[model samples]
Structures are given as C-alpha cells and as structure tokens.
Target: MIMRQGQQLLLPANPLFIWFSLIVAMMLNMLPVGRIPWMPDFLAVVIVFWSVHQPLRVGVVAAFLFGLAIDVHQASLLGQHALAYTTLSFFAITIHRRLLWFTVPSQALQVLPLFVAAHAIEIAIRMLAGGSYPGPTLLLAPVLEAALWPVVSVLLLLPQRRAPDPDENRPL
Candidate 1:
C-alpha cells in the first residue's frame, strides 16, 4: 500500500503480537470492577483497532467470538456484544484504508462515530431484551473509547515500528 508522506513505514504485524494484544484487551475488560456505565470497553476499542490495522486477520468472525466471550463474562443478553462487535468490525474494515491516511488524532475523530454506533447497538439490544437503561453516563463510553484510540494506536503499533534488522547504513 502506498503510504502518506512522512508516515513511518511499519513492519508487517506479527500474528502472535496481534493475538496477544487482543487477549490482553479481553482480560482488561473482564476485570471485576463492577462495570461502570461510563467505562470504556477496552476489548471493543482493541478489536476496532485491529480490524482497522489488520482486517484480514482480525475481522468480523473474531469480533463475534470475542463479543460472545464478553457477553458470557458480563452475563448480559446473548449476542448483545456479538452483534455490536460484528457491526463495529465490519465498519472498521470498511474504513480501514482511508483511516490509515489520517494522523492519529484525526483517526480518533473518524472512529468516534463507529464507537458510538457500537455502543448504541449494544444499548438498543439491551433495551429490546427488557433490560433497564444504563443512564446518561452511557454516552461517555464512546467518547472515552475515542479518547483512547491514539494511545492504543501508539502501543499496538510499537512492535511494528522497529526495524527488522538494524543496519549502520540503513534507516527505515
């Protein structure tokens, strides 16, 4: 893929690193902090990140499976997260190419709507399942996730930023 000017050339992402990061995000989400209404969904953010960065490897299926896991963990309605994550992954994949052209902050702005949509889907699903409203604070989750985008982009891209083989005469 042709890169934008001044964009750092990233090494091919390691499959192991990608999966490990996903697992770590999942574990973070599972932390027993009594799920706050405004708490950002870490797994959702990471899944969207990977979906945008490595769509071929971490697409809708992975999102669905992880969403199922989250649903089971949280004991929410079945497929609530699965459906939301699947949609999120689909949209992330759709925009991945254009998104890469933007700077990190700009990318965050671009993805905010995606995160909002994901949360909205989740809330809609919950309500349809006869669940109580999580309140106005729920609105904060997407914004928090968007705020986290740049940090996640930086950390997850670190492994791919290193030169495969450092050389005295070469600078990548």
Candidate 2:
C-alpha cells in the first residue's frame, strides 16, 4: 500500500500579514480605551496567534521586539511588556503544537495560565522599574485576554480559511 501525505493547504503565511497583525495589536494596546479593568491585551493575543501558527519564525526575538515596541510606545517600563511577551512567546512556541489538538474552549482555558503569567510578570517588571499601579485592577488583563482567546484565534485564523467545499451551501 502506498502511504499518503496530508494535503497541503494555502495559508496567509506571508510575513507582511504577520507584521500588520502585530502592529495593529500594538496600536490597540495604546488606544486608551477599556479603562474599567479587564481589557483585552491585543498584542498578547496577536503574539499568541503567531506563536502558535508561525512558531519557527516568531520567537523570542520577535517577542522582544514587540514587547519593546509596546514599552517605548506606552512609556510604561523598559522591559515590562518585553519581559511578559517574551516569556509568553517562549512558552507558546513550545506548546503550540499540542494546543492545536484542543478545541477553542479548551484553548481558551490553556491561554488563561499564560495570560496570568504574563500579567504577573508585567506587574513585577513595573514594580522593579519603580512604578506602583492600581492594585488588582491591573490584573484584569489576563482574565480578559484569556476569555478573548477564542475570538482572537478566529481572527488570526481568518487568513488561512480553507477553500469552500462543493457542498458548503447545504445545511447540515
């Protein structure tokens, strides 16, 4: 019997889209909205997406750059976002393959821990940099980002949607 390889699919896979997503995410972070606690960390979400889909290319270096960009743009702390994002990307690249097996809800659950870890790290970095922030309200980002996992996943996956099937119009 002949062995068959999995069918290859077309995906955005372009570096431009990746960079665009990242920049958009960074802009969102500085939008000055979502002040009531628990705002979605758009940058984190984008990093999570690229980390999972393009782990080979989007690694600690990219994380470092993105984090640094956020740091410079927001003027929070030099390494606060850098440290958090780098740490998250490191872990995300490691478990991304395994995470692919999980459903959206389960993936959201998985993201929670990463989100928390990132938030904790960011807070720590801020403290280390001599900044005191609003207490627990600052922690809201993690939970919100975690809850947003599914939506972000979908958005990030959009450029990779499969070709329509012949029976796509038919209802189940």
Give lDDT for model 2: 0.80
TM of each candidate vs. truth: 0.98, 0.83
Clashes of each: 0, 0
C-alpha lDDT of all candidate models, in order: 0.95, 0.80
lDDT string for model 2 (1-172, tens) is 2223542354557788888988888888889764454677889888987898799878889999989888897777788889899999999998998887678789989878998999888777777778776577767778788888888877767777655453667422
Q: Candidate 1 residues 1-172, lDDT tens each?
A: 7877888888999999999999999999999999699999999999999999999999999999999999999999989999999999999999999998899999999999999999999999999889889999999999999999999999999999998899989988
Q: What is the lDDT of candidate 1?
A: 0.95
True-structure Cα RMSD, model 2 = 4.7
Ten contiguous residues with the weakest lDDT in model 2: 1-10
**Alpha-carbon deviation at 126 in model 2, angstroms:** 1.4
Residue pairs in clash, model 2:
none
Global fold similarity of model 2 (TM-score):
0.83
